[model samples]
Target: MTKNSAWTILAVIGAIVIAWFLVNVLFSLVAFVVKLILVAIVAVIVYVVMRVFVGGRDDRR
Candidate 1:
């Protein structure tokens, strides 16, 4: 093959590799955000449950 053709192929491969890396990074960020949201939701639910179960305080002795 010619030098120009070889260069073109190399460029294409480089672009593919870069795109793959970017996609992986983006997915990881999204997963982290999702996990945070889930944790927040669970915390709120637990807080509400706790309040319902232990909401009365007797301070008259």
Candidate 2:
């Protein structure tokens, strides 16, 4: 119940809170990057499929 002990406890709690916030932010950024990479892979697959199916119809003229 002394003054110095109270300040030390408060400092420890503050450090834990800040660390948690930083970890959450980092995970969110990683998730966003994964989503973007998945979207890009899907787009490339669709493009290749479309070219295979529709890329030969312009030479009959």
Candidate 3:
């Protein structure tokens, strides 16, 4: 009986640790995705600004 209880406790602890790591990993993934989206948004804004300055000029001679 004692051995069985000890095994159960160990299993529960292991499961909790695994769950904690999984949650952390999911959060990190979400953070990374958010950063990627932010970078894309900034890039698009920069491109538009550059186009207005560089590409919208009339060069008719």
Candidate 4:
């Protein structure tokens, strides 16, 4: 191959690798955020349920 062609191929490969890395990083960030939101929702639900059930017992006294 010509010298110019070799350089072009290398540039294309480098760009593809960079793009792949960026995509993976973005996907991982999205997944982490989703997990955090889910955990928060579950914690809130549990707290509400416990308060409803446990707090009423104190009023019976």
Highest TM-score against the true fold, candidate: 4
TM-score (all chains, Cα) for each model: 0.86, 0.83, 0.83, 0.87
Q: Tell me, by lDDT, which candidate is best.
A: 3
True-structure RMSD for candidate 3? 1.7
Question: After aligning candidate 4 to the native by TM-score, how far in Å is the CA of 3 from where it should be?
Answer: 1.3
lDDT of 2: 0.97
When summed lDDT is taken over every stretch of 10 residues in candidate 4, the lowest stretch is 52-61
Candidate 1's TM-score: 0.86
What's model 4's lDDT at 8? 100
Q: Across residues 1-61, which tens digit of lDDT does each residue of candidate 1 receive?
A: 9999999999999999999999999999999999999999999999999887786464577
Task: Please say which candidate is ahead in lDDT: 2 or 3.
Answer: 3
List lDDT for all candidates, in order. 0.95, 0.97, 0.98, 0.97
Error of 2 at 12 (Å): 1.0
In model 2, which range of ten residues has the least summed lDDT? 52-61
Q: List the residue pairs that clash in candidate 3.
A: none
Q: Regarding lDDT, does 1 or 4 come out ahead?
A: 4
Off by over 4 Å in 2: 58-61
Ranking by lDDT: 3, 4, 2, 1
